[model samples]
Target chain A: VSLNLAFEEAPLRGSISFISQSGTLGNYLMLLARAKGYSFRAFVSSGNQAVLEATDFLEYFGQDEGTKAIILYLEGLQDASRFAKVVRNIVPQKPILIYKAGRFDVGVRAALSHTASIAGNDRIFDSFCQQVGLIRCYDPLHTFDMAVALTTQPLPKGKRVAIISGGGGYCVTMAEAACAWGLEVPTLDYATAQKIKEILHPFAPFPLNPVDAASDVRPMTYARVIDILMGLDYIDGVFMMIPFMFEFQLRSAAAIRELVDATEIICGLPAKYGKPILGNMIPRVSVGPALDLFQKAGIPFFATQDESARAMSGLVRYAQIISLAKEVPFSAEKPRFPRADQPIAYVSRVDPVNIPERD
Target chain B: VSLNLAFEEAPLRGSISFISQSGTLGNYLMLLARAKGYSFRAFVSSGNQAVLEATDFLEYFGQDEGTKAIILYLEGLQDASRFAKVVRNIVPQKPILIYKAGRFDVGVRAALSHTASIAGNDRIFDSFCQQVGLIRCYDPLHTFDMAVALTTQPLPKGKRVAIISGGGGYCVTMAEAACAWGLEVPTLDYATAQKIKEILHPFAPFPLNPVDAASDVRPMTYARVIDILMGLDYIDGVFMMIPFMFEFQLRSAAAIRELVDATEIICGLPAKYGKPILGNMIPRVSVGPALDLFQKAGIPFFATQDESARAMSGLVRYAQIISLAKEVPFSAEKPRFPRADQPIAYVSRVDPVNIPERD
Candidate 1:
């Protein structure tokens, strides 16, 4: 929904609410959400904060029934203490994911000049976020990625991730990426390996943590293997990598249909088994339909294994934050700092500025 | 130009030659180049490297009259010493930008399975690249970004950069990004500051390294400020951030035309003054024509300030590498690593392997 008007075929409904200080960023995010099939409970572009500040919106969303997670793009703040109080109050009930720009001195100066608001000390803000259990994101795309994973998939219980792939190479790449992203890829148990071996052709590699199904496995066998991996008590999550180009050349229609079916089945297992499942498809034009299917199924699909692993790591981190928040109770007290009411000045462009060109 | 046949209105011509190990990556790159209006001298997909490898193509492009930079996507190598010799030989004459995947164990295994070639010790390869003065990139898009900057713009003499923006916020963000990427945004001298202030309105912030022109400054004034910045002997390059949204809202048709004309002028100054000029336009649907204009003028336009800075950094790094390569002479004798020829094995998909599904 835009500031001027709201266009809708139906009422928007989801667990995430996005608030942006920049209208352009808000618009871009809205377009991205529409393209990626992500829904939101509400979207607000707090242009200049003329009437109300981000703190007020946070207070409202604290009691909001629809929003389970909050995503914010804040350039600067008018009242740091009030903002901190609001974050402390709301973070217990919902996850607050923030992308605070102007981390450096130049960025801070730019923020002040752009909005006439002071961006407080970045180090203090970082500490405040850590204390308040806020998830800080560096980029907009990553913010969306983490938000989607948090809202859709169940929070991962641990960092152990099982890598599954139709090709050995993808499995290897994902295993490395998973480890680099702080997720462990432990070797499967001997019994589990024996069971997997019984189901695969002798030419196929032995079933390990990154269980490679040797490129031409039947879809049913693929689904069974994934189910077995997910059911294992030791495995916390699954990272499935699909080699689209190889599969496309083999059986484009049948392979895609089977993969779609398998993904639907796998997605259902996430909720029933309490383990998050993430999919990474080798980016190709032919995989568009398959990607659409995964999106329709409410599965988080990434273009690269590194991105997928990073998202999974975020899920794990958020889960840990929520659990830690449960252990530590935040104090309920108003900040003592005086709140200043600054007049909002809109940038006028009617009288065009003419600067004499120097020789 | 594709593998099947050329479907061209005219012969493609540019100073960059791209070689990919995967056809999918090559095709995707071709699409990106077409969309971004980047012409290429040559594009080769060394599929399986059955007879000829990436080194052979690099050797050929090294002597080609049309090529000035080489971009490679290498999965693995059959003869490491031979590849190193080729890179050392070519890099002195042309910049060789390589994106070598399979840095980790999983990635190495994947590389081997994908193309039946053993990925050698990554650390040794890294040292070899450093010794040969090769520019290494992490991703394909980055490789392309670096190649465009290296071939299209003159090498930067130093790391000092001057950022100019119609919007204060973008300049600030770019300044921070520039510093983070190791490019120094030194404060403008008193003379330079006075000159910029004369070209800007009194209400605008005082001219600094990140000179912010008030949003409504005429496009001609914007061009003049950029030209002045480029002409400064202290500045090595210029990062110009255009506030397209602000201009679009003011007078879209005339503003875009003027902006387009200003960009054309700014692009010409880089060649005339021997300083690199990069641009970042606030990405919006309405700014398509403006972006297209930049692309048509052969100016590298990026989506974000960080990306623009990173590309500039890559260019600077390449320049440094070329200069250093001239100081060190590569040995004439080849190393004693044995050359092995392995038959390419195509992934067969005819016999659908049936594995018993375990309940």
Candidate 2:
């Protein structure tokens, strides 16, 4: 079933473990996912699953201590109920992302002949996925994007996102996207705002939720503001919109040194305080030492505000799922799809009883 | 207002003309948009607009024959009604994109001090944009993505999109995005399906709405299949999902030659048949000769399925806006918001009478 199966290792050893249903398709997906600045510890193409089903691979990856996250590129499943049971047991430990192909009529036909299965043809399967707390990925390639944020950064206590960018444009778009994606962009407190304002340029506006520093704001100032936001009790996540066109701006060694220092300072903030900090470069840039150093230090930077906002929202959703799972423990022995209104329409709510005040 | 504004030219002269309210921020945006495989014809930093307001610059770029598309980065407008009138006139000639920043309380505070206008604060502004046929951009960077598709590709006669990809997973994800964005992925006609099925590999399945040609589809077969789809009366736009890990595969000169030939063949199909052909590289690839050649041919390629799908939808929405504008001519004399249910929630629909049967 795996025709001409090939796999490429990521830049460095990372936590994600990928399992694909098709050999050629899955391996190609890995090559694409790696481009998003994520590395994989292992890749398994369980084509046809003749010897062992997809569930077995899921269970294996779930137990693997090295794998912090598991990503699946599935066409169809032979026994979905078993897969759900296995996924339920692993939700508390790690986040599992599934990109199921052949959902539509034509795609179903392709999957039928290609993989000889119809598990993905039904709508109930998706609700089952939600019930079992399996993250469903719309864009197959973006599956890794959420994984990068989920694995590297600490889970936020709530779905509250803060934006800090030198460009007012980036701040506006990032805040709008965050709000659109079910994440709160609450206004900063007076004391916290004043603390951040002092670090910004004198002409910069009061540190609102986005904390829009002036265009001339330095790298160290950006990092300091991020540190302040991450330390706040109300802020669950921070999206740092860094300056773009660094390749042109980095004219001398001094500029490069400052960038490296800023990267070093910003990268450690995610782990310093227990809230996730996602970097969003003002514009969509492909390469820069700033990005390289940050990614190496385990801080993922997105090219666009939409992506950065969506990734943070996914992280928040993952936390909510985990919290929900805890409230209603899974019955692995029996797998049943609740009525459409029951688990299918699950909304992300800030449950203080379910989520701890802080990690 | 633009402190230390420095601009970098794109690799080549593209059709987009960018106008930024802040010189420094605007120039940086142009540099970033260029990385997405789009070049710019002009970049204007309309700082403060002490004499010439943003609307005046918009009027200038609209008249410039070299400009095929106009992208605006405006935090506030001194004259919203005047801007709306200018945009209405430009919409029929060329697609206009606006990335209006300073939406929320904090962003508004920044905008208030930075430029001194409150046009963006009201919800009526967005409705005005819709009525005026101005394409509102979400992600400042992705505005270029939609612009690339709009400027280079022909206006589709309908909102029917056909996805042809080497991978089944790409087809599924792309189809889902297309549908979500208010485009149709109709089943192919019997005769056309048979013709496409014959061009695919022997094992390749029947060409459905998304002709999921099996793995190992050659460049020539892909090009030929695209040509057939573009020629069909039913298909409006085409999403070509190219193979990934090409850097590894291009070890042989023969492989490179095939890609070059394929690129040449596929690039001509869009313009020849008067339809948009967008490329969705399987994964998120930053660099590739295939992408370079396609983009150079005026066929823009996106890095991910999400971008590819949304961009095509944007293109269709632009066409729909133009169609709607024609049906209900704009009254520049009276500038007022329509009823909340009027132009506020404009959904894309396939109106046969409004849309020409074929161009």
Each model's lDDT: 0.66, 0.69
Candidates in order, TM-scores: namely 0.80, 0.84
Candidate number of the best lDDT: 2
Scanning candidate 1 chain A in windows of ten residues, the lowest lDDT window is: A343-352
Per-prediction DockQ comes to: 0.14, 0.16
Q: Give the TM-score of chain A in candidate 1.
A: 0.80
What is residue A7's positional error in candidate 1, in angstroms? 13
**Please, what are the lDDT tens digits per residue for candidate 2 over residues A7-30?**
544334678888888766676577
Most TM-score-accurate candidate:
2
DockQ (0 to 1) for model 2: 0.16
Total clashing residue pairs per candidate? 1, 0
Candidate 1 lDDT, tens digit per residue, A1-359? 31212232222467778887765446555654544446777777675799887788778777888777888878887887788878877776777888776666666766666666677777666656665667765555556667777777888778888887775545655676675555777778999989988876677777766777776446556667878998998889998865433335346677667766765676578877888988865343334454555666677776655467767877876777767666655554522211212111011110011111112
